[model samples]
Target: MKKTLPAYLGISFVWFSAHFGGGFASGRQIVAFFLNHQWTSLFMPAFSMLIMGLTFYFSMVIAAKFNTYDYSTWSKKVYGNLAPVMAPVFEIMFNALLVLVTAVAFATGGSTLAKAFGTPYMLNTVVLAAVIFVLTIYGADLVRKSATVVSLILIACIFIIYVPNIIYFFPKIIHNFAAVKSGEIVTGTQNSFLDTIWWAAKYGALQCCAIGAYIVHAQACPDKASLKKAAIVGFFINTVVMYLSYFGILAFVDQGVLKEAVPSLFVVMNGVGGAWMTVLISLCIVIGAVSTGVALVYGTTNRLANFFGRNMSEEERAAKRKIHCISSSAMLVIACWMVAQLGLIPLIGKGYGNIGWVSLLLLTVPILLRGLGLWRFAEDVPGKVAAE
Candidate 1:
């Protein structure tokens, strides 16, 4: 079961697609965290890469060595007596957040399609939900494989649309930076350097909940070396795509033309290919949303089944899981549709902003402490003698 590089990349693509959902795909997060800060935001990509790389590596290692794949077991192993208290808290918050974000994806994708094709927004939402439901039913392996292809296509399409914009707009971007430094542009609330660093750290920490299951999936790796390498590769791929999109957004900051709900689409629509490019960009956004929504639903369903199906026979468990998946998917779609009516910005700001801090305290801290050897649990490591 020694995993090859392609095997690692395939999983990494899943990790990337899962995370690159509503906020990242839509360019709203980049605007809030990075683009708003202008040139000072350049450092975020590197800082994010560091935190996520370490987190992914350790998460995979712990899952492999401990034989715990789900977050409930992993948290218990890391938190000890606090597992009862911490596990439910993490599960409830994480699952709810996943539902909220998936809703955002549906809203985002639906709106984009509506603008592009003049289709009814609710119709688009229904279509998006159906696509995610089908994908979730096929389960993780299919999602991972399909995501690999989608991620590659996204990267290619993004670069084709944005790289030239970066070159053509480089001068304007530099000028805008100068204006901001001179206090002439009035770019609104500005974060101090330290504040920017903290935001990057917190954002990276929040991603652990989203990708934790994928790390669990990484347990298929035959050895520690393969797992570590896969994590690193995955981290780099995510980082690179993030920065490329950031730069794309940055290029348009000076012109003040990025006022649309989907700023990335605005960028493409105004760039080389014009209207045709917007259609292609719209497709990318929808696919990104679908990938993200499917991952969230799959993760939520998997967690619930693992939590409640512990005593069921294998056949019984499978039957119950199917029921759970279908019901959860329907619930998520309805909830998300209701929430989407409130708009994307509010959903992301309120939902993610609050959870980010909790994750830092509960999820990230315990895992980091265990991974760094600063804390150890007697029963955490599987296959080890109690005395050892």
Candidate 2:
């Protein structure tokens, strides 16, 4: 069979699927980070996506260039001699992020479904966890494929729901902007430009760490050229969808929609009301959450499986992958459910910003420097000589 997708698009979809999770699809994270900043919400989302796109491009390039598919080996390539110490520290931090994001997915999925179906939140969460667990066990290839399919449906649903609202609410959007500019309304926590940008950058920083998940698929990226294509394709897909969702959510900010757990759903309920559209929006959120949960769970699973199977022969390791995957997925899903009790707002607000700061200090800065050639991995010496 000819492949269902070229390697580049597959990689791109993986990036999109992993990034557009509960926090994003719900529009709560955008409200928490961007819309609260009022007028800065206009461009800060695009800026934040740019930061993520560039960082993803750089990270994928390094991974492709070095041929380090898993985070364990990739960190070794990135950190050089410092790998002995820094790698384990980075692993702990990265796993914390995995847990945090996956937990948000569980929380977001459960809350949305429970509200829509009038079911128990815990029941909804258990079902959501089961779905993610099934997807995750199939491993990276299935995750990428599912991401592409789920993301396509999500994009269509978003356009159907959001475009109508943006058009209908044009007058309110303009009036709100004017109100913010005139100092008649201040939506942000701090009214300063620097503060808004800092928050936006934190959003970017949290996203940049998804490269840990992205690089596991790097082997599919035949070369740096393919990786670049994947990065650009993924970047545009993510940024465009985010902008659409942001504007739709922005139109309702003045209506106190930001106070809602799922602001995008509020936009659908009030702005684009049909019983079907409400269910559609709810479905969008849950699937998006599942897509993210699957990817993050699988990424962490790959790392753990690799560590435990280090002493095993290739045959032995391959045989054991399913076992490792099951254990890892179960452990992660349970942790995520427990953390989900903290609720959506608290996770996006208090939990994510800290991850972003830690990611910037530990992951993004070093990756940026190394990708720019400001620092060299000892592994690069032979490749550098070959080019000469």
Best candidate, TM-score? 2
Tens digits of per-residue lDDT, candidate 1, 1-388, equal 1243266777677778887785677787777666666356677877876776777777767766667777667666767788889878877877767867788888888887898899999889889888887777665566677778778888887777777777888787677767776667645457687777777777777777675457546645636676667778788888888887877776677667445567887788776678878788888888888888877777665666575678989888887887766676667666766777676647576567567667778777777787798877676544631111
Give per-model TM-scores: 0.89, 0.93
For candidate 1, what is the lDDT? 0.73
lDDT of 2 at 147: 78
The RMSD (Cα, Å) of candidate 2 is 2.5
Q: What is candidate 2's lDDT per residue for 1-388, written digit by digit as tens?
A: 0167787787788888888887788887888888887576678878888888777877776676766678888888888888898888788888887877888788878888888788998888899889988888877788778878887888898889999999999899888777876767767574688888888888888887777888787766546677778878987998899889888987876788878877887888798666788898888889888988888888887887887789999999999989988887888888887888777547455878888888888888788888788988556764521111
Root-mean-square deviation of candidate 1:
3.3
| Candidate 1 lowest-lDDT run of ten | 379-388
Error of 1 at 288 (Å): 1.2
